[model samples]
Target: MMGRTVLVTGGSSGIGRAVAARFAADGADVVITGRRVDTVAPAAEALGVRGLACDATSPGQVAALAGELGGSLDVLVNAAGGLPAAPAAGTPPLEALAQEWLSSVSGNVLTAVLTTTAVRDRLAPGGAVISVGSIGAERRGGSYGAAKAALAAWNVSLAAALGPQDVTCNVISSGYVAGTGFFGDGMTEERHRALVEETLLKRPGTPDDIAQTILFLASPGARHITGQTIHVNGGAFTTR
Candidate 1:
């Protein structure tokens, strides 16, 4: 990883931060991005990596990010995403639903799509494109889950397109990762216990768990593995 260049979006905290830390530790040139300068700047400084503030969904900002790279990239991690904001009180039901669904798709799916597109040409032959998905896509994930499901579907085509260049693309579908501020005020003690019980491992997943999986996918050993959705959940959801 000495000469490799890696980019991670939404890397200010949580799983993205963990991924940046891992690659930086291995001596890779790592750059992290978040929407806010306040968050991105400190996280980058603390992790000893470059930080760029860019809203991945915006084409203009993404293009700027690409221009800044001005060279090749070895890894791109689409780790920036989350649930949509709650609608204002008394907002029309249909309008609220529309906003929620649209935001969900944009935040989870388009972020990856736009960011990857911006850096696609910059990705070297041995590079890997990895996106963070969620278990919500399987259960009662609602709009958020549906967006994640869409992300997996998109990865297949992306892998095919990038395969000829020796660039592997995949999605890491995570489940019940703790300490991510993902659940926010919605998570409860009872719910947490139930989630852990549902997993065969009887434990919650963590940022490092997802980070490690991304590292493996970007390594030489996983060169043959692409265009597949890799579930990192702790046996909470089974695939047939």
Candidate 2:
């Protein structure tokens, strides 16, 4: 990864942060983006990478970020998404439900879509575009799961479009990962245990687990692999 330019969205913390750190350690010129300047700056400093505040879901922000890069990108990691926050105080139940669904789709799906579109032309040959997905896409995933499923679907077409350019596009469908604020205050002990038991490894995944996979997918060894969703869920959801 030495001399390569990498961009990771939603890299203020958690899986995104881990991925950025791994690339930076490999001597890549890495830049991380987040919605908040305070968080992004601190995380970038800690990882020895540059930080930019840009909302991936917004075309304006994404365009500005691309302008800032000003050159070809060797890698683009679309890690800028999560479970949607609760709807604000509302007068109607149906509207709140609709908002939740929309939030999920915009946050998870649109973020990847807009960001990738903004920088598609700037992706260098041999580049890799990796998006973070979720196991929820396979099972009883609600709105969030549905959005992740869309992400994987989008990746297939993207891979084909970029294939002729020697740019690989893929998704990393992550499982139950610990040490991240993904669950917020909603994760109960029982829920945590149940999720762990569901995995063949019988333990929650770490950020490094997903980070290491990103490293490989961006490497020369994975040059031939593209347009596939690699599950990193500890056998929680296996595919034929």
Q: Find the candidate with the highest lDDT and give its number.
A: 1
lDDT of 1 at 133: 97
Q: Where in model 1 is the C-alpha error above 4 Å?
A: none
Please give, for residues 1-240, the per-residue lDDT of candidate 2 as tens digits. 589999999998999999998999999999999999999999989999999999887899999999999889999999999998798785389988898899899999999999999999999999999999999999988999999999999999999999999999999999999999999998999999999999999999999999999999999999999999999999899996
> Residue 149, candidate 2: how far off, in angstroms?
0.2
In order of listing, the candidates' clash counts read 0, 0
Q: Per-residue lDDT of 103-207 in model 1, one digit per residue for the tens?
A: 999999999999999999899999999999999999999999999999999999999999999999999999999998888899999999999999999999999
**Cα lDDT, model 1, residue 25:** 93
- TM-score of every model versus the real structure: 0.98, 0.98
The C-alpha local distance difference test score for the whole of candidate 1 amounts to 0.95
Quote model 1's TM-score. Answer: 0.98
- Of candidate 2, the 10-residue stretch with the lowest lDDT total is 83-92
